[model samples]
Target: MLKRTISMTAAGAALVVAAVAGCGSNVQPIQVKLAAAEVLTQAARKTAQVTSYTVDAVVNVKHPQQGGGKMQGRMVYQSQPQLAADLTLDTVDMAGRSLPGGARAVLQGDTLYVKVSALQDLLGSSKPWIKVPLTEQGGSTEVRQLLDQIQRFDLGNMTQLVTASQDVKAVGTESVNGEDATHYSGTFPVDVAVQQLPADRQEQARKGLAEMEDVAFDIWVAADGLPRKLAMNGSKQGATLDATLLFKDFNKAVSIEAPPADQVGELPQSAPTN
Candidate 1:
């Protein structure tokens, strides 16, 4: 084995809460596929009822070049009714290599920092550091970008965009770890092609009929009415990456506090990517 590594570092920087992109996998339509785009949209609107919850995510990532691995992380999702969620992904890993070690990703509200240098053998010495430009733009580059992403997570609003869809279905019920899950399927709309991909890559994906075709997913929402397992297949037809998020162990007491002002890194007069 070449000690393979699949990094969520970009996700850490881009804050990809919706889903991961660039992973290669096959896709196909399902039987009894319901155009329940409106249902999801309605459910998202009701996100207000969900205030606090912890998530233990097991992300099995697969890319064309980078094989695959089951990554685990804990998330704390909080909200003020209609407001966006204050989310956090504690640890993300793949093939044994943990990127953003001792990482603490905060959404909007207060932020948390787990000194990577002080952490145990959770990371490597040569890991790539995120080079985010810091300006006199008030908050830290990390903080500002994080909050913006959270705000954009207007689930209720975005669900509205699920107007029409295809190849949708219900994969009955399955066991994720131990919890019961109901699976649903759907394809991504062409209108949102740019949303799931980078601008340049979006153009490439659009050259063929694949542009109009929707990306399919077998979303396993837990019986508890929350998203628990998500099997995001690729553009072709087989399983690309599998993600099972365990919501059972989620405890509310996961303490969250903002870093001290002194501990805060100075907004670069022109700081380097550390």
Candidate 2:
């Protein structure tokens, strides 16, 4: 039960980040101002030229009354010929006790694989991996619904935010992770950011962020133009969520593959999917 709770919460966090990109309320629009916007413009173009990258991230979450959690993880994301990510979360504390062995989540196209331990003996197999097939291949409707919400969190939203931003000028230089970086601050225009989404995705994206207001975000870029850190904070009447992701090792060589066939099992109909 605890595992299920943690997994679902992680999925929910992804959905929230998607909503924060856009969707309005008492939230005013952002114009993507000229001065600061140019900085982001350059950064965006530089990032677009890269192939793959690694992110060493630390994220904190807060809910209205339920408290929150902390997660320290690393992600290897590839976008050249294809899109995929391999993630290893070393620490997760979701309002309760910290997760024992942390967790692993891999995303390849529409498929997601999650592993909680080095052994899956709990399911009668020593496999250690639980596969969640986001497609129609297999999975219950409920499971699919929850996983579907996380689909928009591809980390590419940084591009959209930069392109749509108005005022994000340099604040000062700060050391991010270990490298020197230029810190920039601005209030991201939720409406403008949402408009950047593809037509088919616009409505859903707006709906997801409909209840949010007072959005603020910042990003740190290195001398080479690569963003070292991205942080966003948003809140509504009773709830608030803050998220941050750090990027490193640009053009990192990585190969993302599913867990070994013999060491993976389908997600139980009881959980989410597979």
Candidate 3:
């Protein structure tokens, strides 16, 4: 009789253990793509309603030949902010050549103020700041294009990217800048992403994405539904690009003003006689 009792107890214990294991295996992570997309959409709306805020970013670009370059900078954005940025490139190198001194750029309105220590000899009087008006008629096309790329570092664009992603899922939770955040991983197909944009923007977005194969992104969203950190990786032409952006101090007071006229110099005109 005691043997039978022992056998029964062992059976009960085994069943309990199996039940606990089943429960553990059933645990599921929250689906992030659609849900997080909705959350981020609302967050984007709220962000658009804000007057101003500050953005801090670290930009690293790698080339196929060398280790690439690094730039860290900050921007104070107000209203829609246009496509403007005020940042200092901490370190820059190209094809194993290190640029002398760091560079600073202030892009506000339609004007771009650039100061590069390496180009001082070529700039002559515009030693400190070269103020260039982005004009289609006769402007530095390269500089204008660079400024346009820089302007894309806005929250609105980031949110749009998130919503347009083909697959956005919660991978786990992490602390970003000391705040608890939910980490999401996803991918963006150029064609699919373009379809999500407004009609007015679809063509432009399509043209931009035509060069890339696809983009993989990871975003950390705080409890407030705002993205705290973003990482993107993509390849174009044979080179890969990795970018990281950190967001904080949302709705914070910020002031952005163009440099004084006296301190700014117009781009030198082409040699009088070609």
Candidate 4:
């Protein structure tokens, strides 16, 4: 009887130990918020090191009454030698009417060449490609302003926004573009974010953010410390805008050349009225 009792007690203790070991194996590492911020900063630094990259973006716009529009586009940016882009606005729609065809833009050496489906009729030119220098004198004030805004859309500028945001925090880990990535989110005040910019850039950043109430960003950084995906949301004058970007082929060599001179045409002397 004594032997049996001792055997039973030993078995009970062994079972308890096994259960404790099982729980230990299932424990997850605690994530500190500060640690997450550090991770994001590191990731942003890594992204800034890249000289060139490609982005795929889908944009949705919603208005109170005029209806909304959707745009899908791809952009390639190369920083070395000079800033350049080969971009195609693959599809666009507004008020349920689809644009006739894809719109394209190319930037090379302070000049931007654009081909817009809607402008084809207005310009009355079969060449379709309109070349405008990036100077105030080349196009209307509004057109020049729009071109300036587009020129600032790049990954390095965006990473500055992330680093300067006070509300940035890590959300968690998730799969982005089929790779495991750490997620971070933040809301940034336009004025505050602008203040973080260099003196030379603050004015431009302020101008861009003036129309936005606030910008919300969500970025996913892959294990290699590079951003794999990013989303931005903002509202202005009762209209809501959302944009998503997928980054790939970092530091990859891309060939982008100016459109053939024969295929390019100058913007009409008479600018279209708004």
Clashes of each: 8, 3, 0, 0
lDDT of 1: 0.40
Whole-model Cα lDDT of every candidate shown, in order: 0.40, 0.61, 0.54, 0.61
Question: For model 1, how does the per-residue alpha-carbon lDDT over 1-274 read when each residue is reduced to its tens digit?
Answer: 1111112332342323433211101212222233355345433344334455555555555544544544455555555432223234455554345655435543333432333332212333232222123233543444444444444442222232232345556657788767776666776665564445335444433321123345455565554444444443333333254444344322233344444445434222332223
* TM-score of each candidate structure, all chains considered together: 0.54, 0.74, 0.72, 0.76
lDDT digits (tens) for residues 1-274 of candidate 2 = 5345434435443433342211101212222343557667666656656666676666666666667767677767676456566767787776564657777777777777767652253455466777777776655443354345444533444555556666667788899989987788887666778777677665655444434554588888777766778887777666665767767767757798988888778766554222
RMSD of each: 9.3, 6.9, 20.4, 21.4
Location of the lowest summed lDDT over 10 successive residues in candidate 2: 20-29
lDDT of 3 at 137: 64
How high is the lDDT of residue 80 in model 2? 49
Per-residue lDDT for 114 in model 3? 71
Give me candidate 3's TM-score against the actual structure: 0.72
Per-residue lDDT of 262 in model 3: 80
Give the number of the best model, judged by lDDT: 4
Task: Please write out the lDDT profile of model 3 over residues 103-164, one tens digit for every residue.
Answer: 66676767778766544445556547777777546755556545444433235544665677
Of the pair 1 and 2, which is ahead by TM-score?
2
